[model samples]
Target chain A: MEQPEELIPKKEVLRLTGISYGQLYRWKRLGLIPEAWFIRRSTFTGQETFFPREKILKRIADILRLKDEYPLEELVRLLSPEVVPTEVAHLDPLALAPIGPEGRELLWKSGEYAFSELVALACGAEAIRRGAKPGEARLLVEVVRRAEEALRAPTDLSALLAEKTVEREGLLLRAPLALVGREPLLLDPECRIKVRLDLEKVVEGVKLALGGEGRG
Target chain B: MGERNVTISGAGRIEGGSYGTVKIAGSGRVVGDLVAEEFKAAGSAKVEGNLKAQRFEAAGAFRCEGNLELEEGEAAGSLKVVGRVRAKELKLAGSAQAKGITGGYLRAGGSLSVEENVEVEIFRLMGAFEIGGLLSADRVEVELEGRARAREIGGEKIVVRAGQRSLGGFLSQALGFLFGQGSHKELVAEVIEGDEIELEATQARLVRGGKIKIGPGCRIERVEYTETLEVAPGAVVKEEVKG
Candidate 1:
């Protein structure tokens, strides 16, 4: 079986992080960790638990770094990907690191922004950072905003900025395409890929930025 | 007196509502969801829907059809929950059966049976248990009078003693009548991981921990320890790797 993301065994994770089994399971029960991340697979020895390499490592790191400052319950609110701050009404989306000055060009109007709008702004800002045209960034924002529900489960979601160029006789017409969908996104042979943004990372970044703001 | 006290001294049924104290001395039933400051049931009682109470005490058969959110609860007879049970501290004397139980401290005397996981801060059991999924806690102490089974058991400090039925044959007989007959003082788990683990009459596929002590009558397939490993006589460990 071919997995798109690398996986690490449960034992290896404990050894690498020097965390105890108690801490791992405790975090899991407290919702500091997502239940879906625990992937049990049958190995030659016996049944074993595995995790997505990057996601688990980063989540454990975040928890360890913040556990001292906040209680486990508060840490869940701050760090758990399962917890989307749906009630957030941020006054300045640009102040968030993920949606900085690059988002200025994409902001339609900004008195107060909801969580989904902030995520949209972040997507646009990230696209702009990747050298996308302002219009293209706006298009990506529009594509990602409707999929705000994805932030709760934020896994295997991809945002594609593509172009389909049609040439007839001596004329060439370019149509910029923007779409958000689950991974393994198929495209037409004529469509050239411009930027492929992983929505999971973008969503995590926005969540963390919002969490920081909450604490401050 | 914002008086809302439901007292059913005999066989009766009442709709669920906010009550100061619900005292059911006889067989009774609650129709809908219930939120009460305190609930005291002496005879057989059943809650058809969810229940939220600050304090709860029941003597006879107590059954909850829906989930129960309790601050403190103590039951003398059989307690069964069809859905998950979330309590700050729960003590059951006879037997407890639930879909899932997560709390701060849980102490069960006779038996505990759960379909999913029981994640708590401190778990202490005297007689026996059957957990389909993981049973994890900060500190797990089990004095096995009969047999227990779990898919996986993990914690910080785990100590399982065998045949510590200090209450003698009376309670064991009662427990046998409730749960099952005494087969052996043992625990069966696929994996048992903790910081400090001490086992007696435990059969596990893998036992991973630091400072592990395996006592008599334990049959472990493999043990991977970091600090130290001590196995007493009559314990079978197929493989042990100490780091």
Candidate 2:
């Protein structure tokens, strides 16, 4: 549902963030906040700027948290998902528990995996070990696999891991889904255990293991 | 050479080459160059290499890291191209950000940002538009609903005016007003050169044309016209030079 309260005026954002106009504009130029977010509105006084309240606030907080640790350019690279090469052999086996022989084989067969794929594999393996049927685990893996292949940049999987429900043999099963984009996957109701993985955390872990400083 | 359709429904990656038709309903990635007769994506797609397509359509987010060449393209959601884009017809209703765009016809209704030059035969815009470099077109029409900016605009015929509200537009604006979501309407340009030009609600540093009509809500520092120059009551022009 759309709400009027979703937008906040530029004045309000500045007041809340305690930042000046120059800082806001500089950040905008540096690609910290998207130009689309700077909405122009006709007010009684004149034209004013507005932004998506939640998104801007979160971005501002992220920039503040990481500004000291990294430069603006580095922050852009970290915040923005850019596709990069990753080797499957670098993944920690301990973290990929419950990965069935088939899933492991798939990883071993492929020389490299996208970061999103790594997250998906780990989630699917964990789900299978926690009581998901083989088919259900495969579906989970498929979701992440597609995301890894489709996305050109580093993807934020957290948005994709929404809780979903499935019906099988007249029984309703809550299937916690992990996704990267808009891919749809079917899950079997035979999966009984709750599947939960912090994909963001996993991405950070993968990045750190790959010698990149983890996100702030 | 043979007609083929490849659809990726889940997470998938294509090494990138040539295909008859490539469709993505889920997440997809292309690592290298892609040549497709038709390309459609309903989900998100990322291409790390150049993309050449006869027709391209995307309803979800689409990103291309390298150059893009298409006969026709339509985007109803977000699109970002890091390199140059060359198309015959490009229509956008959601939002687009491109490094540069050269097309035969360009129509945008939502938001657009071009980091470099935009050269088109016909350019039409209704919502927010920003160009960091020159915009050259045979014909340009903009019904401003929000802020529009360009470094320079050159065309055979250029028209910039306030948005005209139809029945559906009035209803939407009424709802937006009730919901406190109304947008401003303004156009800003550093320089404008055209054969014939009409401007309203525009702020420009210099305007040079063969025939110029400065309508209401216009502020210009200087104007140079060859044949005729008409200034409406609400317009402000500091200096006028006839050549």
Candidate 3:
């Protein structure tokens, strides 16, 4: 089983990121930060807030980097994973930075692609970037496309490809399976995890890529 | 569409629909949802359904069964909303109650009770409040006349003070019944965080800020500060850490 993701305490996040409580709350109110990211747990000192380590750090970095250029309201549209850019429809999926040339193979019948479709294509493209086979990437895209409902609670969600070996009549057979669910996605003893992708990050990337194009 | 004006001078009952100006002088009850440009009521008025108006003014007892959406609203005696309230500007004089409130400038003179969050640009209260969830604002100023409890309070600049003893009977008797009878005015919260903070007569588990001043009659379990920390003589803090 993969190690559960690290959590950074609220105080530590403020210290490490050099952001004050007011700024954090303001961003939260503005929807630049998702409510699901604020994980409240009862620590020794009453109730304390925590955030996923890598995701919070990356989100804060992106916000701090772009806050100067774009208005905070616009930043919410560009960065928030919870915001699905449904109004976006593009003729070519390869134009987005997150998809790029690697996305060429994920195309099915591409006159115009909706926002979620582009996100699915971007997921497959990202899988390919991580050295997965084209077929495996396609598998991930299919699973993620059906996972539209999962985006409502994007935090701690994972997409994975597992390979299982079966012995039948003294013959060995391999089966590959793709699935998506909340994290700590466990597989049985015979299955081996081939690829794991944090869907939150991929969703953010797709939003950022397509969002700028729409706004600009 | 420009709907006709509706006015109930005395006791009346009306079906809820679109209107221009709705005024209820006496006891009034609406059956369904109301969409109006201006809603005005005096004495006891009740809306069984949702209310959406550009301007809303209520006096005496007013109650809405569904949500309240207004551009600007002011209530003098009592206002109660069963569902959430979204307004650009909300001013409550006597008492107000809601499930949740999200607005711009919110000023309450008397008791303000919210089941959940009260997030606004500016929140200023003169009497008592009990917020089950977080009370967050750009600027939060509370002049406490009675006991107040919020799970968490966060803002840019938060200043809370104990008001001089006035309105002793109505506030004390009403709020005292809710939070148990306590002679001294106090604010209780689990966590209080802000950039610039100063508090008095407050009890909190954790107080965090950039510049924090623990004023008189305060008991805090832990205090974390980045810039400046000052603890008054009467205040008691279990732990103080400057980071």
Candidate 4:
């Protein structure tokens, strides 16, 4: 792709922003602007950095506007992708993508549900449709939700559900947990249930499945 | 009261204390020193005092005014630390500016600018780095795409090579020339010392190693090797010594 004329050099960015190099780097560290936005290019003199002109100008303006109202730490969260606790009952069922009507209904029936919980419920609904028992599927969803909560990040239901097996009292359940990198953790010692799921994979999956829903 | 997890989802400030996991999803500030098993910040965060954690990860902007001690540190946004940093693994996919860093493994895919010394067991850079002080590592590998500089480097095994410029790079350079874009593609260092060393597209003052291989686009003031040495076609060495 051809270079856009809107790319402003680092020196120019500083001059226009009326900020020093120290302030620029400090803001970058504080997450006022993303590091990827700092574009490096080979110059006649040496390697110099550049930034998208309008984007940088606007970002700096926003930072200045909110600097006093919120501390730097709080500003980072305000500027980042919002993680709102969503209630399934409050949302329109038709707007959820990839999830079928049955799955939507199942999620709506559940009380308050976070976005990750909704994804987990969808996975459970899919498993039940695939001939798994209803009770076992519900257990799977609960387990996936717990795992997501433990990870403290959005969890992927598809990948987590791919190899998950629900074991019943003294009987071999459906599918055994696929422990890729980590060891097995005894979630319920009395129930003799052990579940191993790749936390990183689950997080990545949730990000992919949810698309833009959880980003904001 | 001890909390298992503490999450700040809005604009909030946390007085430094001990916690199992500290997560900041929105803008937050830490007033005093903090101790946590895991510290994760996705939004902007600032720590006024020191921080000790097993794992410290930030995807957005983070700034630590005091010292930071972490077993594993990962940053995808920008991180600025005014005090010393000690970590087992430090991974950067964004930009990091630190006063001094001591780690076991340092991997960077973005830019790193350190004002003081950097000592690591392994140092790998796929992006750009500038170190004002001495850099000592057991293993050092660098594929330079942007630019890299260090006052001095000491390692057991060291390899430095130029990264391939993408098609976008060529286009930008062409446009840059016409539109006044700066184009500098070279690695600069004062001195390099290692047991085994390989260099390409680097400009340095002195290099001393047991076994040395100088590849293309290398300009060196002096080279001293104990065992073996190989010089490529496009390398320029002002002085060479064998012992």
Which ranges of candidate 2 are over 4 A from the true structure?
A1-216, B2-4, B166-180
DockQ of 4: 0.01
**What tens digits encode model 1's per-residue C-alpha lDDT throughout B1-243?**
385998898899989988889889989999999999999999899999999999999998999999999999999888999999999999989988999999999998988899999999999998889999999999999988888999999989999999655565777678778656655788999999999999999999999988899999999999999998999999999999986
Candidate that would win on DockQ: 1
Q: What is the C-alpha lDDT profile of model 3 across B1-243, one tens digit per residue?
A: 767998998899989999999999999999999999999999999999999999999999999999999999999888999999999999998889999999889998878999999988899998789999999998999998788899999989999998775556776565555435555589999999999999999999999999999999899999999999999998999999998
Candidate 4: docking tier: incorrect
- Look at candidate 2 and tell me the lDDT of residue A82: 41
lDDT scores of the candidates, listed in order:
0.88, 0.72, 0.88, 0.68
The chain B TM-scores of all candidates, as shown, are 0.96, 0.93, 0.93, 0.91
**Measured with DockQ on alpha carbons, how good is candidate 3?**
0.66
Per-residue C-alpha lDDT of model 4 across residues B1-243, encoded as one tens digit per residue: 666788899889888989999999889998999999999999899999999999999988999999999999899878999998989998987678899988778998667899987877788986678899767777789877667889777667889988664547654453344224444546798778777899998898778767999999999988877779999997999889885
| Per-residue lDDT value at B6 in model 3 | 87
Question: Model 1, stretches more than 4 Å misplaced?
Answer: A1-3, A157-194, B1-3, B179-181
Question: Which 10 consecutive residues of model 4 chain A have the lowest summed lDDT?
Answer: A178-187
- Fnat of all models, as shown: 0.62, 0.00, 0.62, 0.00
| Rank list by TM-score | 1, 3, 2, 4
lDDT string, candidate 3, A7-103, tens digits: 9999999999999888898888777888888899987778899998888899999999999988988898888888777777789789899899998
lDDT at B140 for candidate 3?
96
Docking class of 2: incorrect
Reference contact recovery of candidate 4: 0.00
For TM-score, candidate 2 versus 3, the one ahead is 3
